[model samples]
Target: MTESPVLMSVDDRGIATATLNRPALGNAYNGEMLDALIEGIPRLAADPAIRGLVIRGAGKHFQAGADIHWLSAAAAAPPEQAFASSLQTTRAMQLLNEFPKPSFAVIHGACFGGGTGIACCVDVALATTQASFGITEVRVGVAPTPISTHMVHAMGLRHARRYAITGERFGPEEAMRIGLVHEVHAPEAVEARLEEIVAAMLLSSPAAIAVTKTSLLESNGLALSAHQVTQLTNESWMVRAGKEGKEGLAAFREKRKPAWA
Candidate 1:
């Protein structure tokens, strides 16, 4: 497979790996990276040979969330343009959450904001003991609107309400305890756990797994309506560009806690 900046590769064993390649920035999300994931996910989901999907970061962190530079730019954009950009990331996470095959996230180091959103959407989430998580948008004066659905689904409304409002960073064990992650392993053991999950996924019939996942989503009422998803996305961007959002972003950039804290 051709290696794009945002790497995507599929093995004959039917397991596909999508690695966020910008390790220098802790694999932060930008328009290009978001576009790559948005385009790649549906393609992989459509492939007959691909039975499982794995998402990881190439270096120390899974993802530090949105790139600060990008955030700053988005903050300066017109409301409509900013909302459109924000929705792209939201839609990508939604797609992964609703994907037919089993999806897994191998998380380590920092997984915050959008990164946490991505991990929450996966079927199986494994994190290194050193991993840190937060719904950090609040610190930057933005609501966790885009990721609120998945956050609530993974960690429940009570937990989401606290973390989303506080933007507190929690460790991997706490994440597992709160039902955000399935397992907490040593950093070195992450790959081994991923292999185990892949092997287990392969043992089941693909069609059955897909149908079961669909049934479970329906039964649990976890699926989002199109209008709801759009509304959330719009709300997230709107808040980010508002006065409170600006204060939060400025406080973070200046390395100080927000006034609300």
Candidate 2:
């Protein structure tokens, strides 16, 4: 039998961890892992015993973003069906971003694409100095719509525009400079900071943490409604079904510069 696409665990201390489990692919996302995240995150949020959450990727790299092959196939398939399927990733991000309680990410290796989105959704994102990051969707011709709002919220419009459009790879310090990450440390020190933060949350009042998180989202207008979800999904689908998305995916698989490039 195949291993589960995502692995989740909650400790007696109430620190819950959701790990993306596709290491052979640098923890890149496919449909099954996206589905697992959409299902797993909210279920953990609803559990009263859970006091905090951490998102990580298994093996070396964090998450490298959507599976390029998946996008290649998606771009070639029926638009509506492909869009709906891709929306599972959006749903997963929304659920985690809106999850109540303190959350953190211990990022290392390659935290690109959806990995950056996952980092943004958490309350605190700490990374190793060796870590690398990117908002890489445009490199392959697909829209980064699914994580756009969160990216903008985390990095602000100026930074998001520069990196999102360029799809350049950056180190953790650059990520911190742009506000995509909170703190940077040596690989050995990152886990200690993460554990310290989780421990601090464990000592706090759960009700207060939840209320504060809710109020923050509300105050910033980061919270979403059902209509917004559909709208974003539509935007994502349109881009993926467009000429650029097709060309980008093909070029990636074919290992060539896209025609426009």
TM-score of each: 0.95, 0.97
Show where candidate 1 strays beyond 4 Å: 1-5, 257-261
The models' CA-based lDDT, in order, is 0.88, 0.88
Task: Summarize candidate 2's per-residue lDDT along 1-261 as a digit string, tens digits.
Answer: 999989888888888888889999999998899899888887888999888888888999888898888877778889778877668878888988999878888898998888999988889999999899999988888778788999999999999999999999999999999999999999888888888877777788999989999999988889977888888888887888889989988888899999999
| Top candidate when judged by TM-score against the true structure | 2
Look at candidate 2 and tell me the lDDT of residue 100: 89
TM-score of 2: 0.97
- Which 10 successive residues of model 1 have the least lDDT summed? 1-10
Q: Candidate 1's C-alpha lDDT?
A: 0.88
Clashes per candidate (backbone, < 3 Å): 0, 0
lDDT (Cα, tens digit) per residue for candidate 1, span 103-185: 99999999999899998999999999899998888778878788899999999999989988878999999899888899999
lDDT of 2 at 241: 80
Per-residue lDDT for 183 in model 2? 98
**Residue 233 alpha-carbon offset, candidate 1, angstroms:** 1.2
List RMSD in Å for every model shown.
Answer: 2.0, 1.0
Name the lDDT value of residue 3 in candidate 2. 92
